[model samples]
Target: MAKDAVLVLGATGRIGRLLQLCPPEGLALRLQARRAQAAAGKPDAGWRLFDPLEDPAALARAATGAAAVLCLAGPVPGRGAGEMADHIRLGEAAVRAGAGAGARVLLASSAAVYGAGSGLLAEDAPLHPASAYGAAKAEMEARAAALGAELGVPVCSLRIGNTAGFDAILGGWRPGFSLDRFADGATPRRSYIGARSLAQVLGALLQRPALPPALNVAQPGTVEMAALLQAAGLPFAARPAPGTAIPEVALDVSRLQALLPVPLAPADAAQLAAEWAGLEPQLRQEQSRR
Candidate 1:
């Protein structure tokens, strides 16, 4: 199979690291990071430093000859107006760079864009982002989509769900973990995807003849925090959930499923745990090898 080259911005992030450990098959990477120092002494690592804000042309040059440009650079967690504005600036840079290369552009958005919602939220669901983070992602999606339309490039926002190892409940687990138990005696439920699955989804999207403006990337259903803990053999104490707590934010991936021949993940607890445990440690092994 012929490999398609992809230029990945924010290559040093957590999700980026996961991608490094489990890249999609038949896809070559041109990695961009914040620091040149990180790429030093690694000839085969495919690492490069290109700041779109400083020199958009450098990004364009780097993205040339790629099938797609995947910009995972995102705002900080708080996602204040200034932070979101900065993120939008980066997103705009991505659009221009991809347009310069005549390649599709994929920007990383978050499920937080749906905010505190119960049941399955589809791509067409209206934005009701609760936090500054959610609002910031919403802004990025709108701006990038609008700009992509103007630029005549295929730009899509990936409304990605929680990855198994990247979620607060899993990654934040300590010796004594405590979770909020809502009045109905349930912990927060969320959609999640595995590291390898996410890579495949992105790869598949890049190869698709047509791309949707926005897509929800996740396993088929929702998983409770407690179920995740149980699957991982981690015990947690339950405290009453505050009024601010959201019960669920499940994504409707029917669209994603229809686009691909393979089935999306089934949202089983054991499999989520296995995927996280299996994929997260490989990063260290990969680093050691590199």
Candidate 2:
């Protein structure tokens, strides 16, 4: 089997690190990070200090020669960076880079793109975002999808749900997401997938035969936020948003399962949520004082 070299954006993230672990056999892996100095000396690491807002051309150059580009870069909630403008810029950069490089791009989208709608969400569900964050995600998804068709590239977007696990990437101080919002009775029910499983899905995509651009990557199970906190031994209560209702953000993974060789399983979401809960207090304090 011919191997495909993959360029991973946001190479230092939780999912990005997992991409490094079991990359397709014989395919070279290149990493692009904001902080080249931080990524220096790491094996298979290629640092590109390209800001999403400033250097689209440089990003395209970095993405050149790659068979596939896995874009894990974007504004994350509570991270103080996933704001609407920033996310849009990131999406724009990704589209430009992927198109210029002529690489099959797999963009990391979010279930939040579906917004706070009722019923289980699917890839084609109506996007009615309730928050600026969700709106940005939806906009980015649309932008990437449109660019994929316009540029004549195989661009697929994965609407990921709550991804868990991995030590460093997602463990630090970032506020505004559900986990932190519902830390002590913040939000209600939600869905989650382990980072390992999320990585497995990405690996499966890398290995699968080329197809039309479209797919959702997520676990099957949907766990409530309160139960998740309890599982993690944290205070469990209802931390409802004032004007927002938390809708079920389930990414139907059946499409990917039908196409891929291996199936993804749901790990202990509650346990994973609990673990993050344990760190919430400390993280909150660190951020408050900052």
Candidate 3:
């Protein structure tokens, strides 16, 4: 099998780290981080200092000779106009770079683009973004798709689900964060994919000759918030907002399933909780430093 060189932007984030740790077989990686220091000691994989917004040439350079460009770059969480502008700029840079390189492009998007919904959300579902973050992602997807069409390059917007990771599970219990519930007192269910599964899906997508315009990436089943907390062995308190309806964001992953070599199982909340428990102390220590 030939090794396909893939350029990954925002290569220092949680998802990026997982990709590095468990990359797809026969895929060579070129990881671009904001700081050159972040790439230290990663000799097997190509590394470069890149700022998508400020260094457009660098972005193009990074994409050169790459089979695919995996864009994970975006503004840090903020609802301000400046943050939204930055998010849009980052997406534009990624699309232009990938198009210039004539490589396949995959933009990491969020399920929030589907807005508040109760049933299985498909890729073709109407986008009704409720938050600034979600709106930014929707804009990115639109722009990337248009660019791909104009440049004759394939682009895929992956509406990724909740990723099972330490911060995702434990952050709910952090102070000032409240777990949401429906007005009827039912915990909202959400589809999620483990880090390993996510890596596998990305690998398969990168290797494919043609790509779908959009695909919902998630596991087979959904998990409830209360069950997730219980599995983590944490005391739960309802912070139900009166008249606020929590939406169940379950994804229809049949399209992704058809592409994968094996079917993806629903995430094991109990097992994820157990893993989070083991890292609780470390997580807390890091939180304190922040």
Candidate 4:
């Protein structure tokens, strides 16, 4: 059988690059970025230029004939107003394009939408976004969900947890980068997933006929920052940041596990950290230059 085509926005981003490297079997991928240069050397047939804010038509064109639309385009934290507006516009365009193309839409959301709170955060957890970035993501989720409903298209807002990337997780042990601690000076716990696991989960989501309105994508176990650092055999200091008190956020992945592949346990995260230790020297050099 011919493979279904899927459209991926932000095709050159961190997650996008991972999906490209390990795409789901039996799916043809169409990757969209702001410019062709952004996807240089990638397969030309699958690459296209699309600016959601400036060129909605182009985005729609990219979405045409796609079985699913994975919207991953958004501004990072601390971006200016124009960039934030663009991020909002991108979300709008994604739903419109996906609905028009008769494709399922998956919006990549963040765990920050749950705000600071202790205990397992389910998909229906109260949304009390603590920061502007979190608030923006919450708004995006709401808008996308509404638009998908209005257009009669299926949508899934995936609230992703702290993803342990090579640089962030391994390099976290170095000085100047401290982990968060509670009032008792104990390292806070969080649910985390590695990049490879995240990719597998996303691939599974794409194959589903229908999905829950929202789901928390995370690992099966909660990991303490101190334990993770210790397992990596690195010295680390924990300090409380000056801010309004917030509870440690832990995501409930029961729904995710039921639908997707089994996620890595907390011990697996520590093991992965140890495996990546050799890259710490290079990561530190890169961090110092930055």
lDDT by residue for model 1 (120-197), tens: 899998899988888878888888888899999898889999888777888778988999999888998889887677
Q: Give the distance in Å from residue 146's predicted Cα in candidate 2 to where it truly belongs.
A: 1.9
By TM-score, the best candidate is 1
The segments of candidate 1 whose C-alpha lies over 4 angstroms from its true place after superposition are: 79-81, 284-290
TM-score on alpha carbons, each prediction = 0.94, 0.76, 0.88, 0.87
User: What alpha-carbon RMSD in Å does predicted model 4 have with respect to the real structure?
Assistant: 3.6
What lDDT score is found at residue 33 in candidate 2? 74
lDDT of 2: 0.64
Tell how far residue 160 is off in model 3, in angstroms: 0.7
What local lDDT score does residue 278 receive in model 4, on the 0 to 100 scale?
Answer: 41
Clashing pairs in 3: none
- The TM-score, computed over Cα atoms with residue i paired to residue i, of candidate 2 is 0.76
The CA lDDT of each predicted structure is 0.84, 0.64, 0.77, 0.75
List clashing residue pairs in candidate 2: 75-82, 78-175, 182-186, 185-239, 186-239, 232-274
Model 3 — TM-score against the truth?
0.88
For model 4, how does the per-residue alpha-carbon lDDT over 22-133 read when each residue is reduced to its tens digit? 6778788888878766655555548888677788888888898999999888887678756665555677788999888999988888888888866878988889887777
- List the candidate numbers ranked by lDDT, top first: 1, 3, 4, 2
